[model samples]
Target: MPRGRPAGVPPIGSYTAVGDSFTEGVGDPGPGGWIGWADRLAALLADRHAEHAPPGSFRYANLAVRGRLLDRIVAEQVPRAVELAPELVTFCAGGNDILRPSGDPDLLAERFEQAVAALRAVVPTVMVCTGFDTRGVPVLGLLRGKIATYNAHIRAVADRYDCPVLDLWSLRAMRDRRAWSEDRLHLSTEGHVRVALRAAQVLGLTPPADPDQPWPPQARPLRSQVRRDNIHWAREHLVPWIGRRLRGESSGDDVLPKRPELVPLELPGAVEA
Candidate 1:
């Protein structure tokens, strides 16, 4: 059944996603490449709107590339999004900036405020996302305070502009290993689905599943096994990440946005990721 636009709901005919690996679908794989939460949310929004729009008129774009910093996203992607002038825009950058030791949360939020101000001027609805709680993760755990601080600043910015916020910090289910990819930095496929659902909830849309669905309890891992996993993660993922930093090379150094323009949404491109 085609869902009628709910009373008081903001009708989204078009949406443009802006961000880093999280929005770029770094961990979620589709035939097109990585299918992130942005694409999934686009699917949901499209379904709700397709019935009302002219055939194939409901459109979407994704300007996110992995490994992008907030400055670059604001400096490069933000202006382009403003030009596209979509009815809806999602802004979820600054995580890459948070990871840096010298990155200032206050300064990043200031830049973010400017970006949101620009988007809100032309866009009817602008959505933003918060950083995740990394207290249980290995290396990221150490930076939990910084992430929290940045998240606070983001929330304030969202409030100032009346923008909807997808809060990743309170998603307790995400602490589970199943929600994360092998790299430990990005979300797994399941995580992406959960986040998509959560984003829908934020937008006053009905999601098919609960983002906070409880996980089945299991026995605690043996300390030695945990040690082994840590060692393997360090070897397979951590070392290479460190190497990239030392060499000042980024994963997105040459990458481009998969979908740079607002077009009809394409989906279900499932691949054996």
Candidate 2:
């Protein structure tokens, strides 16, 4: 890769993403499955590669399985990604660890730093992301301070390695409730679209258009309605999450990466299985 700013669009010969559900496209539902920001960005990279490189030159791999912690990502996915040696690598993990009540934010950051360092050591261009604010969340709101602290460490680590950062904390668009799914834990499809565009900008690629436009005001629900919805959400999403935690299970326990190999990205409208 070149040192200075890219002449025009940077050529992404290939891309490999590793992390938890965020990178796995959990919230953003697709016809085949979830297509998160990583896949969106890969499509963009593929378009660029088509213009500058050979047809089908751009390859992509996603080793991210949902519910993975920093150590799990480093232990399981990092080595495989390093072996693939893609031109671009996006690593977004440690969010799940930060959400845990028992984990130490500082220690988690240390582990996150190691993962970033290891990836940077092998991959030419490494990208990382910070956790978003949790003020709007119910039980998770208490961890706002911790999330901020962890984000600071993420920025520091990226600075240390001169890696590109997708600063999710700085994205004010995410503050809107519309940016998240009903569960409030993962991003909505629109949110993933915005993130993908921002990540492309960080990598010096021009997105077709911005997805961060302000959302219009929505009608407020009644207090009773809000309470009922919260209760339902707790029963459906929260309880299951807790049950999994108690049993040491993960949503990705039996899941595999949707795309495990570096292959040519389909066109925007094409479906993935």
Candidate 3:
């Protein structure tokens, strides 16, 4: 783990994040990777600590790699993260696996399971698994089915581990074609902010105050894409969802109430839910 505040540096809860590109702020542009969800989540956690009058502050390290698969995360990121001994750890992966034409469902499941097991061995961490985005790919025809299978597998793995899972798959914004970047894989700046806010909510972090006015001067694509408003949706919705689960709110496969219909594709490992 990286060094924290001096012994006198005020004890803030520590957080560490690991996974692939989404975790890396692949398309976000800003200091502290603020464009990415992980950074936004960290900020929210820190703000929450501030509101509470304090036992400590919030510290975070993001070690996500671009294009990283679960196997690589297990072999590489986890070891380094364990050193941080974080109080909270969030992971966003499986997009690459689902995108691969030949990726195996069982293999993906096995790798995800191993990653979770390895993390658990290190710390009593709160693990978060983000769902995949199926709308933006050029090869959506080949990748759609696999994405759903991977998400279901992720849910299963979360259940097995008794960890909280944020159902990003059900976020209404993700299904909208206009909500993506030009690459069709990455989120637009606005999308990234939305994702960040949502993840914060999932983690039970307080949202930042809204801007005095509506954001984004205009609906331009590459230039005016990022919107900071309502970015806290996740904090409002997902955070409570996680808290309920932690408080023993309910069990028995708590899938989100409404989800987008799975787009059918002829891919291996694809299964109907």
Best by TM-score: 1
Give per-residue CA lDDT, model 3, range 1-273, as digits (tens).
111222333323677878776776656665433246666666556655566555334566777766666776677677767766676677666666565555787688888787787777765655666565566543464566777788888778877876667677766666654455555556666666666666655554434532111444545545323333223434554456457545744221232111011111111111100
List pairs with backbone clashes in candidate 1: none
Ranking by lDDT: 1, 2, 3
The per-residue C-alpha lDDT of model 2 at residue 4 equals 22
What TM-score, to 2 decimals, does candidate 2 have? 0.93
Q: What is the TM-score of each candidate against the true structure?
A: 0.94, 0.93, 0.67
Give the Cα lDDT of each candidate. Answer: 0.87, 0.84, 0.58
Global Cα lDDT for candidate 3: 0.58
Pairwise lDDT winner, candidates 1 and 2: 1
Higher-ranked by lDDT: 1 or 3: 1
lDDT at 81, model 2: 91
Rate residue 67 of model 3 by lDDT: 60
Candidate 2 C-alpha lDDT tens digits along 126-236: 988888888877998989999999889988998899888888887888988788898889988888888988888888876776656788889989999989999999999
